[model samples]
Target: MPPERDQSTNPTGRQKSCARCVKSKRRCDLTQPSCLRCTRQHFTCSYPSRPAFNAIPVAEDNSPMPDSSIDNVASPFDMSLIQGHRNTSVQSRQDTCLLDLDVNAGLESIGILHDLRNTSPMPENQQTIIRSIRVPQAGECRWELTPSSYARISYAIDRMKQAPATMVLENQTPWSHPLLYEDCMPRVLQEAHATCALYLARNETNSAFFARHVIDRVKELTSSPPPTAPLDILARAHALILYQAINAFSGDLQLNAHVCPTFPHLEESIYALYASLQSSETPPSPTLISLYPATTARQAWRAFILRESSQRTLLILCQFMILLHLLQGRSYCFDHACVTSKITTSAHLWNAGSTIEFASAWNEKRHFLVADLDFSEVLEGAGPEDIDVFGRMILVTILGRDDMLGWFAERGGVF
Candidate 1:
């Protein structure tokens, strides 16, 4: 047969078509689903022979485009001639463009646009809109936020922008309503106080190191890019965990002395406390904000005892140990001493004196010089002189001291 007649070609014309028919500009059979030409071309084909209807006419004003552009095209009835030409040109261009354009080029443009959009900082207004959408608190990846929490978060970000301190999230007690502590972690207050104490004790380098490491970690958790504003909820929660870590370990004497040795005075005291302890003696109680003896006398006492000032460091260490123990709860009694070495001894912690006994010993040994105390003199002949004076004073005072309680009470005892 004459190459079987191309049955797909209608005898007179076509009423339906497929994409292949449209591209070839051939009249379609106007079939419901697949036109003959498309079926032959192995293409899934359909046509909307009747034009789609639009209920609302598109306004010509310069408003942003609405979701449905298909509905608003000028009706073919009013512009059939122009519509035909436009349709032919559009179909021709579509075929040529699809055939000639590099498929990879479109993909590359899309990738570039994706990267640009991803890297760009979100607009503040858009961020506000997105943040308003709540996320679930607990579950398989749902997000929810209360209105109050949202306000706090926004306010916190604003504060961070104004002053780039690390952002902290605090969960106040359920009973409390107004959430008094600005940053929920009490440890920030503790750290600040610790820093002040370090400066007062003149441990500049140690203070700087502590500030750098811990502060940097806080900044890392609270801000994404070092100097960025306060973080979102997730970041703030992470920062809170860091504060918790600090609070838990900041006061451990061994860790504090070894890790943050800024204040010679504080570090020395810490060392002395450790040195003086009998194997059985408990570590000092946890330090708190109101912990006391906030006076120049205490400061001077600390300087002398640390022996960064004057006197034999060991002797000063011995004196500091005895005095600090007396100031704390309970006391020690020296039944027998074991001199492990020329400089080291182990004493026992015990309780054996009334207020009267302590007072009597204090009265006899008490020597006050009106001159401004100079530690330089104490260190001149540090070892024997310092040890003897301090040891005798501790011995007699513990043995026959009644006034110790009064002295401690007057100064807000360490315990």
Candidate 2:
């Protein structure tokens, strides 16, 4: 057996490891300021000012990063910069890059990001639910996000940024427009976070694991009390649809084929997202509409946000589904397949502010020429400029997207 090396020779006792090593859960060979590992990788070697906080052994160092690079340090939104040296080993929520837009500002955001790199393997049937730092909601709303889930969430949010976040499809109800304006941002961010873990998963097993986590999260979201309002439905369905789309397009052929068939699960989830959204052909009750109006313009503005947020998400799901089928040269049509036939009924939708405006828009009984008709039927009657149903037709057009939306922008129209 080899003898252990002596540690007494001119030592700085314990060396502070950078957040990267701490996060990576690797041993830090204290090589003065910048460790050998950090130098090799070119990762920013940062030391916290205060004493060690995490269980990992850390050396004491209070020196701050040079002021010139301080602005470019790690943020929760973009951790690529690496967390610069701070007094506290772990950053406070204020300094965290996950700053709230509005909906989650005061509301507790449950669960920290799960590190996918360190996730343990789970069986095919059983899922691993690690930890969720959810808002201190009445205990009923606790959601368990598996470890490394944060990376998934971050991934989804990053992809969602490629397109505009606002735009209602041809739909019938404007009553929820107020909800669309404000609540949409956080909800979508959450959905993005929830699905990214599964969709962008590195392998078949991890992708399945994350997919289960997403389904579990959705189940928890819709459990017990059950969603009572259209806005709630919008939010919940948005997450479901995003998860479904991400799972379907996760781009892992092995996972999609051998491990899990995308068709069965995809159709199942599509039905799940479309579930209870349209219980009846009629619009929601007036009482439900008046139940949560804005108290101030800020409140009203927030409510309006729901329209674009939920609307855009739905549109993306629809368009992305078509885009995928187009890419694969598959013949499965969205309008003919599942619950997409409601787009015509939903086409009466508009950006109405007040409940009265919403009611007016709802009562207009406007018919999108393509509504109640399948893609083939609609395509026959549609003029080049006519807007078809809410999600399907417009998506087909964008399948040939040569930055068509941008071209619309050039023509002073919101595509």
Candidate 3:
């Protein structure tokens, strides 16, 4: 029948489907080298071993197919090509699995295939290296917010919304030094201030332009290579934080969506700057005030300002993230324990306009080095005058308005 269908190649009367198709119970158009179904699906095709008698080579009388016709014709069995195809299929599946796991995790995966190639003796050395790098210790000032406390925090956030614009315009915050417009300020910070000012003063006609400019500026800053100097890094982080605050509070859906993805980059920049500051030879502390000579005192004062600014920025950023999550109806998975860094609570020291003034305030006032998110020390040792705007915000958030007002009343000061 049909001239005795080519029995020299198959030997048996019936053609067998590939092992994979047999397992899946799907029809396989048995094609040698691989089957049609497996080829279309990118699966590894394998066939069962034939008996020794059926493994006989093709007869010399049958002419071999030309190179051009090889793809169309069924080729003779080759073990090397089959093994390679199987290996490739396995690798593809593994890659797909890795991607799926990463997407489900909502964060980067680590240590899954520590040394898939077996190229190193110490498979976990990479992780060990990462662990070796030190970061500043986070504070232990975690707390839960009741509904009233959350309302107070919300009110405080509303008040703080105008603070950024004011800081840029009037140099009001600890981070916005009076000399910010001078040569010492980085170009990026200066531009950020201008952008914030424009955003505050946006009109219907210029709103679209402002949005595009702000989005582009933020992308540039976040995507650029990190600066090597600690001050440069801090400057970039400060600028990004300003943009983040504006976008989050601007009530513009488009702007808010654009900035949400850059939160991680902003956080990394802040932590990197903090680590650099910690490792520096002249880290800020209470003892820094005692450093002698006008030049040394000025240097120390600047260092203190930088460190305090970084700490305050970090605390504000964390609260902003929390606020944004709540607004978006998402549960924030915040690690409250990670906010342990100390903040300078004395308004006099934080508001000092010069090195001499800072030193005078340091000696004259009773400043508290409270944990960034903790207000207990501030309430115990510091009077209302000693607390700055940043400190008051944090205190109100943690203690609620009624308790904070009580603290002010107890200190014989208006809240």
Pick the lDDT winner: 3
RMSD list, candidates in order: 34.0, 21.9, 20.5
Q: What lDDT does each candidate get? A: 0.27, 0.35, 0.55
Estimate, for each residue in 32-129, the C-alpha lDDT of model 1 and write its tens digit.
45643343333567543433333333334453322212123232111212111223332222111111111101112211111111234534433211
Which tens-of-lDDT digit does each residue in 176-256 have in candidate 3?
A: 555534447777887887887788789889888998888988888877888877667767877877787777667666676
Relative to the true structure, candidate 1 reaches a TM of 0.14
The C-alpha TM-scores of every prediction are 0.14, 0.32, 0.60
Ten contiguous residues with the weakest lDDT in model 3: 97-106
Ranking by lDDT: 3, 2, 1
TM-score of 3: 0.60
lDDT value, residue 240 of candidate 2: 47
Q: What is the lDDT of residue 259 in candidate 3?
A: 48
Badly placed stretches (over 4 Å) of model 1 are 1-316, 338-415
Worst 10 residues of 2 by lDDT: 99-108
Quote the lDDT for 33 in model 2.
62
Error of 3 at 136 (Å): 30
